[model samples]
Target chain A: MKTLETTLRSLRESGRKALVPYVVAGATPDWTHHVEAAVLGGADAVEIGIPFSDPMMDGVVIQEAGLRALERGTTFESICQELESLETEIPLVAMTYYNIFLHYGLRRTAGRLHDVGVSGAIVPDLSLEESDEWRAASGDSDIATIFLVAPSTSRTRMRTVAGLSQGFLYASARMAVTGAASDQGEGERVVSELRRVSDIPTYVGIGVSTPAQAHTTAVFSDGVIVGSALVKIILQGASPTDVESFVRSFRTALD
Target chain B: MDEINAMGQPDHRGHFGGFGGRFVPEALMPACVELEEAFRDAWSDEEFVALYHRTLREFAGRPTPVTPLPRLSQRLGLRIFAKREDLAHTGSHKINNVIGQTLLTQRMGKTRVIAETGAGQHGVATATAAARLGLGCTVFMGEVDTKRQELNVFRMELLGATVVPVTSGSKTLKDAVNEAMREWVTCVADTHYCLGSVMGPHPFPWMVREFQRVIGAEAAWQLKELGVDVPDAVVACVGGGSNAAGVFAGFAETAAQLYGVEAAGGAAVTSGSPGVLHGMRSLILQDEFGQVEEAHSISAGLDYPGIGPEHAHLADTGRATYVAVGDDEVIGAMRLLSESEGIIPALETAHAVAWMVREAGGRLPTGSTVLLNLSGRGDKDVAQVRAMLMEES
Candidate 1:
């Protein structure tokens, strides 16, 4: 199996930008269907968010979806159980708060994700200083610990995170939380900053809401991640087929 | 263990034994690093120290006298002295920390401050500090708490602060913190997150406690001056444990046995396990699946599911004893303090009083000399208490 970093690197080497969509696990009874929808809609990877009670890094849309998922009895075990039936070959990444993994036992969580075909993890609240343990645990399972570099990250810190990151470095396009409505971001500058220090694949996210926004950010970075815009569709009762078209639109815009 | 003996300041990287560390998003790393550097520099400079002292003395009305609660002491047979933080400006120990943070904000060239509040005491204090420093202030409060603490909302507005009602999650103090953190990400360039407690990532837990250390320092001196060198026990209520940590800093190395009282429904030290929340790894009320559990208390200020990281370490190391008190007992204790000593302690502080009430003759022993940190006034809780009393009657 190709590693997450190699897969993204190969995709970028072939001049194809990566497309990833984020979906909250158990937000709906058929939330897994949405991940499959994004997979079939031409996404290179799918990011699954296990519901946590307090998501300090998330904005309104993701928070609402997480709460909805929690009300539906979502848990790490349930999310992994759901992922077992996903039936997708695309790379999968798990996005969540640090406590979810910390409480579940870091090594056990990493092994569990690997068992469920998850190739990477994105824990936003876990800083680089506190990530050595999780990084080692994930490495034991050959799971990539993807790291984020924000617009406000210092020059020295940017290089360290880029080097420590196992998968592609996530470039948060703005100094804002996920699902914020505005499209104004510092994607170009941040991506260039990462490019100057490391030769890894970088994806710009956080404010990439519209297809035009995705098209614009993809011009500078290796890929673009769409979260709140797609999650909004899922939260408002959009069917799997509807989500498929939504992901396809961004895929088309990027291509 | 040795560092903990010196009042538990986290190491250079902010690890308090095994509890506290910086766990925040990448967006805020630079700000945390910058703030840590700024704080280190300002804290050691004699000029900065002088300015901090002058502000506390003149603006916050510091050196709040230690009051002898004679009537209550006689009734309980435990000679008690109350460190009257209720007399401080803004009516709480919260003002001391805010004044220091707002001053530090100006020093860092930040022109605005943002904070999260549960019952509004911290919000009011933050607003007051910002007003004094001519800085813009915004406070995020849970929508549920805003309804429960309407007067506090109005009070913050009166202090010229914009109060945003957070509606996500359980819509309480936890959600308010989430909102404040989200807001800080966007505006970190010019705004300082004047955290209301000794919680959150890194510098915040250590920095907030350093600022709040005034409570212990003042009470220690006053006690010595009053010819009591060291009390038998020193106690305070714990929410995020700021005031408890503050008062404990003075007596941690002394002969005084340190005690922290927590609301039964919100007792992180008593009922919680180590888990990460609001950026710090601390004792938190969480489900088996690692999801944070909602905390319930009559006082919104104490209605939190987690305690400060240092408190968790202290509990783990057995440096202090922590116990829980119920809402019913807290209410009774509130009335007792008010009627007996003509002092209306905030329901948050009444947890300590309630714990003493239950243990005075048993665990605490009769005639034991005790120093209590009366962390806040109850004026803001008057309406809530009245409504609750009426509902009960």
Candidate 2:
């Protein structure tokens, strides 16, 4: 399977914007199928989230989805195993916190993630200064360590993060978590600033829910990450087909 | 004088029982090492010690009395004692560590102290320290925690500290820590990371414990004066393990059985194994491949994936026995303590009181004494406690 870095580079070269879909592991009994369905629906990458008990940054929709996933006994290892069993070669990224990664030794986690065909990880809780262990452990393991840039990120820090980050920069659309409204103009300005400072491809996430929002973000960035909106679709009683159909709509919107 | 470990030799590489070590990125290593050296040098200096004691006595209201809980003792069938840290400045033991760290930050020529808080106790305490020392202070807290701890945010702001509401992942204490750590990395030149507990990487666990050791040290002196050479047991709740570590450190060489009670939502020691968490090696509730599992105690303070490195070391070395208490137990104990002792402990501390009641089985000998470190008062938890009580009723 191609790594996230390789896939991102390929996408950038091909003039093709990336499509990353986030799925809460075990949100339902058939969450595995949903992941497979997202892949089939033309997702360029998949971000699997391990549900937490007190998810402070998540909105009501994402929090509820996480709770439902946790209720179904979804665990970090279980999700990794699930990803390993998949036959598809789509690049996988785990979006989680430092605590989870810390609970798992960085080297061991990097190895296990590599074994399961994961190409990258985006730990929202890990600082660049605190990421050395992870970076070193994952250096030879073929997993890209992704970092985030917020609207409030300073230029110097942005450059530093961009320099350290592999794969792509997870540019937050606003100062809030997923499922919130995007400050379109502010997001654009931050994206432009980040583009000027960063050498890596940047993808805007955290509140781009609609086709128009995705297309709007695509104009300035290499990709747009849609999480809460997609999760909301599933949570709002949408069927798997509906989710795939919605994702296709987003893919077309970006294209 | 007894041979004191002056160079802090035991803290080499900052491992307290394979629990505390600087497992962070190389970028953060230099800063951590510098801070460790500064803390050691400052703490060892007689002048610094004098100033620390002065601040504790005048500003923080130190030497919090060891109150005999007659009603609680009578009800529990054991002589129960309370080390009233809640009476300290800002109403919690959090200030004890914050004051010491803030002073160290100033001595290190740092302009700012950045911290993460859950119940806002630490934030308020940090703000107090910043105001007293006239330094810039910034605190990162989860959005949800900010809402629950709104008054605390205002209080921090009132004290001239900027309370940045972290809107990222599960915006609680853990996420707040993430944001603070991130800020610290970027602003390491001018900032000091004021960790609230005895958790996190090497020097943090050791330093915070050293500052908080006053709790245990005073308790020991007081307990001896109260005609007890050694208590049968000492109990304290384990969030990031500061209070418990402070009290436990006093009884480490003694025969007193030390009980470190963890929130049962996801007990790091009981339900987890040795792993890296928050840039330290400690017992963590993690997956098979070592991803930290989310913790879920009713007490926000105890809802952490890992314990302090020293606590992990203590647990491993069998110096301290670790136990777990559930939400219901903690809440029940909260009411029991309030009703019996007229002291409402922070829900985090209630975990320890709850364990004593449950594990004691009403069989503690009448003469057997138990010293429970009442880490903090329950003012911050009144609303939540009331809601829980109303629900139960």
Candidate 3:
């Protein structure tokens, strides 16, 4: 597996913006197929979210997907093993909280994910001050540690986060969780400001449901992230083909 | 002295016939060991004691009085005294523990303090400590609790503490605990987990009890000055058992009969068995597979699946007799105390008053003195109490 740094370097060299597709692992019975379809639909990297009982920052759509994933008993280890079996060549990122990571030891979890060809991780709840332990434990595991930036974040904190973030900056489109509709005006401002401070690539997330929002976001950042909308599509009992079609449409809009 | 010694060994680890051990995860084992060592060292350090006492006196308003319940005593035909912890700073005994723990948090070089609260009493206390110490504070409260105790949430916020509503699990105290523990595990380097009660793992129960022991310690001295060496009985409500353990710790060596009253939501003690709930092994209502069943009680504070480990040990050693009071009985006792004594007790404390009323009617002698730990004031519980009474009426 390529390191998160290497993945970013390659993306920058090719002048190709990275596309990160987030899907709750085991949200449906055939999640493996859905993940494969996401990659085929033009996703450069994939974010496999481990479902937790209380996803405080998730919106209704993502919450439902998380609930379905949890009911399916898709544990951290199980998700990692499933990702390991995937034939997709795209970099895989595991997005979860410190609880799941804490339940599974930091080093062990990071090491296992790296062994499974996972390229990076993003823990929304893990603050920068608290990242040192995880960083040390994930040492040379070749997995990137991605951090988030909210509009409410101060310049000083953003600099600190950018310095610590190994892969890219997940610029939250709004002050709220996933699924809330994004405001393009605010998104543009946050993206522009983050670009000034963040040395790494920035990806805008939260509420970029339609192809239009993704296209608008692509102007200011390396890429746009669509989480709640994809989960919503899967929860609506859409087939893997339907999800892939939607992703392709979104990718085309961005291009 | 004999009673106190019988309650536990001379070490602080033992409290009046109950055993306290450090049962924790391997990751937290080192922190617990360090805390135990620090606590021991601090206890012997005169400077530490002096600082603790000064803060207790000036900030926490220590040495809360024992008020004689004249009207309740007249109605019940027994001498009734209330250990008035309700008058303490923050209107509850919770502040006592928070003050001590916050000081320790500073001593440990932690920059932030995190706590989990059920009814928001502990959250308010923790916020108070954080404000006084100028430290960052985060309180995890169940979403339901935040809704129910919106005033306290505002109070915590006004005190400069961030109140994070936990929407997980049953969306109550237990889930708040889980969230706080999760935060602690990740932020242990710069945060102190200010446990609300004598629950959770090892040092928390022991440490909270020591801090709360002031309740019983002051009450014992006051009772002795009044020429009552040993009261006929001492009663306290048991939620996570902090108040009961604190009050009981003082008379552990005395001949005074100790009684812990639990919420009788289908008779918790009589119907439950020894099982692990939360992080400690205690008497809990559980299924055959050891899955903990939710406990039902009108009092949110007492609506816990398990009692504290020290309470379990006290029950096991027979140092304290355990009893459960039903919701109806507790409500009746609350009314009786409010009408007769004009002191509104918390629903948790009403459980103990109910037990005293029942025992005094059929068992106690006319001249026998009974002391009840009025663990908290009923201000926070008035709305709930009114709703419960209206439902019954």
Candidate 4:
């Protein structure tokens, strides 16, 4: 399995903008196929969401998708078991609220994710000041603890987040959760702030939905993370081929 | 006594003995950090303190009397006194927290405030504060709660606040809170999230408790004035445990034993384990998979699956005890208070009354002097209680 930092850093060093697609692990019975579709769609890394019952930070679309996924009996253990069947060599990052991991036992979760070939995690609700224990435990298992930087973040904290963030820095495009957007959002500005702080593999997310938005974000962000837009497609019963096409559009825009 | 220890504050970084900490999204970390700094500065500034007290005094009605519950005390064979927070403006102790947050909102130059409410006491209080201070108010409540609490929705609207019905998740207080956090992120630059309870990330659990400690502080002095120094027990109902924490704050150093009553179905401290929710690590009612379960209660205010972080810590260290009462008992307790003392307590507050009735001679001594925090008026719950009575007959 590819390590998150090695793959993303190599992509950045080679001047190729990265494209990461996100999908809920159990949004569909064939959700793993959707992950496979992203691989086929030219994704450099994939973020898999372990659906949580109360996703405090997600917008409506993702929240609905999570409810659907959880109704189908998706759990942290269930999601990890399914990842074993995945054939992707690219680094896989799991995203969810902090409670899921804190409840699952941090070291056990980190070790299990590593065993399943997962490279990093995006526990959005875990702030930098409270991430020390998780970071150390995840780091011991070679599982990167990804941190997010927002437009509202002060420069000093941005520097702190960048210094502690392993694998990559998840740069929020705007001060909003994962959802749809009409304009390019704050992707460019936040990415620039992150760029000034350090040369970490920063990916702009939260509202990078459309192909044009992805294209714009890629111009400044080292990577563009397309989440809700792709999850919305899968939740709407898009076939693996259709899901591939959706991700391919963002991939094409990045290229 | 030194006031700081009397009303405990969290660590400089907001750790309430390993429970309360900032666990919000990075997008809100700056806002949380800013709130912490502002709270510390304002809480210490005599002018801000004076203004907070003045608003509570002249505007919201402070120093709510500590009344003796003679009839119920006679029946239960216990010496009982009730701290009448129900007499405060807006009919609940929730007004105290909102008044403080709304004032801080203006001080921070924020022009709008957003809040989450379950049964709507907090929302009504926030709307009231916002209207008084001339700030925009948007309250997020669960779609289900909005239907059941239409009057509160109308009340907020009448107060010039927009009430957005949250339709996601369980469509209840838990989901309303989720929706509120999502909304806060989008407007954190110009809005304050006026959290209702002593929950949420750092400063909130600590901050709200500080605002509410006035309840305990006043009752402590009032009891002394009544020649009752240091009651045998101090009791209050626990939702996110603001009232309990507040009252406990005044008597934590006292010899009085503190009891926080929880609805049996929503007894986080009584039956829950350590977990994270609403941006704090506390005792949360969750399934085996760590998914938080929906709390059930007759009162909308106490229908939460978690207790406040400080409550969790207090429960851990044995500084205070937590107990649970049934909905049926809460209803009976409400009626007993109404007929016995001409005081109708909110269903949420009746949990404490119910526990006192059951434990007065069982767990507690028959003649012990007990102080109960009457956290809210029963006017909002009378209709629900009426329907329940009719159904039972």
Q: Give the distance in Å from residue B9's predicted Cα in candidate 1 to where it truly belongs.
A: 2.4
Better of 1 and 2 by DockQ: 1
CA deviation > 4 Å runs, candidate 4: B4-7
Q: lDDT per residue, candidate 4, B16-124, as tens digits?
A: 7879898899889889989988988899999998999999999998979999988999999999999999999999899999999999999999999999999999999
Give the number of the best model, judged by lDDT. Answer: 1
Estimate, for each residue in B101-174, the C-alpha lDDT of model 3 and write its tens digit: 88888888888999999889999999998999989999999898899889999999999999999876677886
Score chain B of each candidate by TM-score: 0.98, 0.96, 0.94, 0.98
> 2 or 4: which has the higher DockQ?
4
Better of 2 and 3 by TM-score: 2
lDDT of each: 0.91, 0.81, 0.78, 0.90
- Candidate 3: where is the Cα deviation over 4 Å? A1-255, B1-3, B7-25, B266-268, B363-366, B391-393
**Which residue segments of model 2 deviate by more than 4 Å?**
A1-255, B1-11, B287-291, B361-364
lDDT tens per residue, model 2, A178-220:
6758457357877888878766888988888888888988998
Docking class of 1: high
User: Model 4, B18: alpha-carbon shift in Å?
Assistant: 1.8
True contacts kept of each: 0.99, 0.11, 0.02, 0.95
Residues B176-235, model 2: lDDT tens digits: 876776567557878999999988776888889888888988999999999889999999
The predicted structure with the larger lDDT, 1 or 3, is 1
Identify the runs in model 1 with alpha carbons over 4 angstroms from their true place. A180-184, B1-4
